[model samples]
Target chain A: NAGVTQTPKFRILKIGQSMTLQCTQDMNHNYMYWYRQDPGMGLKLIYYSVGAGITDKGEVPNGYNVSRSTTEDFPLRLELAAPSQTSVYFCASSYKSGRSSYNEQFFGPGTRLTVL
Target chain B: AQTVTQSQPEMSVQEAETVTLSCTYDTSESDYYLFWYKQPPSRQMILVIRQEAYKQQNATENRFSVNFQKAAKSFSLKISDSQLGDAAMYFCAYYGKGGATNKLIFGTGTLLAVQP
Candidate 1:
């Protein structure tokens, strides 16, 4: 399986510019997530989706928006890129529901974005 | 909201030796999951090990294992037979049990350096 894949391995955006980070999973998982990792920091959840047509905000969803139209795709949109938004972005997917302690989330390679 | 913490910002170990990275989390929920993910220079989030809150037995995968202390809310990763390939940033994450939208909360991360 290709697992989870994210496009644009690296990108640079001017302040106030907008862009979409693409994520797709071939695992047919119902749960997907978006996270941003700053240098010297862990990761902060941006948005998550339980299934197609359903999405929810996460800990750091203020600057981003997400849409899950199909089971394989969940794209994150940065409305107004800021230097504060510059970080490594990751996409993940899990076959199990959120409440299952046995669930394992598979992650993508990550997209590094820089806002200037 | 749950929070994960990694007290050590950086650590070092000699090859063939053992190193432990400490992690603690705060959550009132009785059922949840924990994980340790390794990110090398390639920027890939690789799952090293996982633990269930209800399981008392520790989880091990080859050279990687975890010490999960439910009462103390502590989870630590031990890497035995450390190798240069093991040098990476390790992240501690938490997943609360049973929700339509299960999200993972991550700590600040620990950078491990394996010395030859």
Candidate 2:
């Protein structure tokens, strides 16, 4: 089974352009997240959803938007792309949060976006 | 807000040898989770191992093991019998338990190189 699938493995856009990065998971996880990884850097959260229709801003959510319309899909939207937005994007999902369980995040193959 | 830190920017190990990657985190909460994720050249983030704050036993996954020190707030990854395919960027992540959204806080990664 494809645990997580992301579309448009690579894309290039001009400054101010907009695009969407699509992510889908077959694990039926309840939590989904969008993160960007810069060169030689760790991932930074952009947006997240605890469940369908429950999106929230993350640490670095200024230039991005997200929607969780279904348990399987959570898409990330980049509006007015900037040079700083040229990074690899990853989507991850996890099961419900609990005190006794370790919330293991399953990640999709990243989407590489380049803004010029 | 919780924060994760990986002090080593790069580490190299000989084939069949073992290597340890260090990670530290800062958080006021008593219960949380720690994880190590590996991102290879293909840019897919894969879970290497995980540890829960309340668990005294360290987590291990085959060749990968974690040294979890709750008092010092450190979670380190140890890779045994390093293989060429093991070279990747390793990220340390933290998650708080019982949060409305269990979002992960990632550290600046450490690039591990396996030398034959």
Candidate 3:
């Protein structure tokens, strides 16, 4: 089963350009997250969705917007791409939450977006 | 706010040897979840292992085990008989137990290299 899928494997956008990174999961998970990894740095959370119709901001939500219209899809939109937004974006999903709740997130092959 | 930290930016180990990647986190909640994810050159984030804050027994997956110290708030990953395939960027993540929407807090990743 395809756990999580992200579109636009790679892209190059000029400053002020706009783009949307698509993410979908077949696992029917309740939690989905978007994160960006910079060179030699850890992944930073950009946004998250608890379930369909529910979305929330994460640690690094600037320059990004997300929509969770369906349980299987969570899309991140870059309204005005900047050089600082150039990074590897990852989408992840998990079944549940809690100390014992697996909480193991299945991640998609990241989208490498370069803002020039 | 909960925060995860990976102090080691890079680490190297000889083939068939063992290497340990350190991780520490801070949170006010007593019950929570911790995880280790590996991102190879492909940029796909893969779950390596997970640990529950309340569990006294450390979690182990094949050759990957965790040294979890609840009091110290440290969760380090130990890879035994390291292989070339194990080379990747490792990230430590945490999730709070009290929230209805569970969100992960990630640490600055540690780059691991296995030398043949």
Top-lDDT structure, candidate number: 1
Model 3 chain B lDDT-worst window of ten? B96-105
Interface C-alpha RMSD after superposing true interface residues, each candidate, one decimal: 1.9, 2.1, 2.6
| Sequence-dependent TM-score of model 3 | 0.94
- Give candidate 3 misplaced runs (Cα > 4 Å): A97-102
lDDT of each: 0.91, 0.90, 0.90
Where does the lowest 10-residue lDDT sum fall in candidate 2 chain B?
A: B95-104
Cα lDDT for residue B1, candidate 3: 86
DockQ of each: 0.73, 0.63, 0.56
Off by over 4 Å in 2: A97-102
Model 2 Cα lDDT, one tens digit per residue, B4-116: 99999999999999999999999999988899989888998888888889999999999999999999999999999999999999999998885667778889999999999
Report the Cα lDDT for candidate 2: 0.90
Q: Rank the candidates by DockQ, best first.
A: 1, 2, 3
Q: List the residue pairs that clash in candidate 1.
A: A99-B97, A99-B98
Task: Record all residue pairs in model 2 with backbone atoms less than 3 Å apart, i.e. clashing.
Answer: none
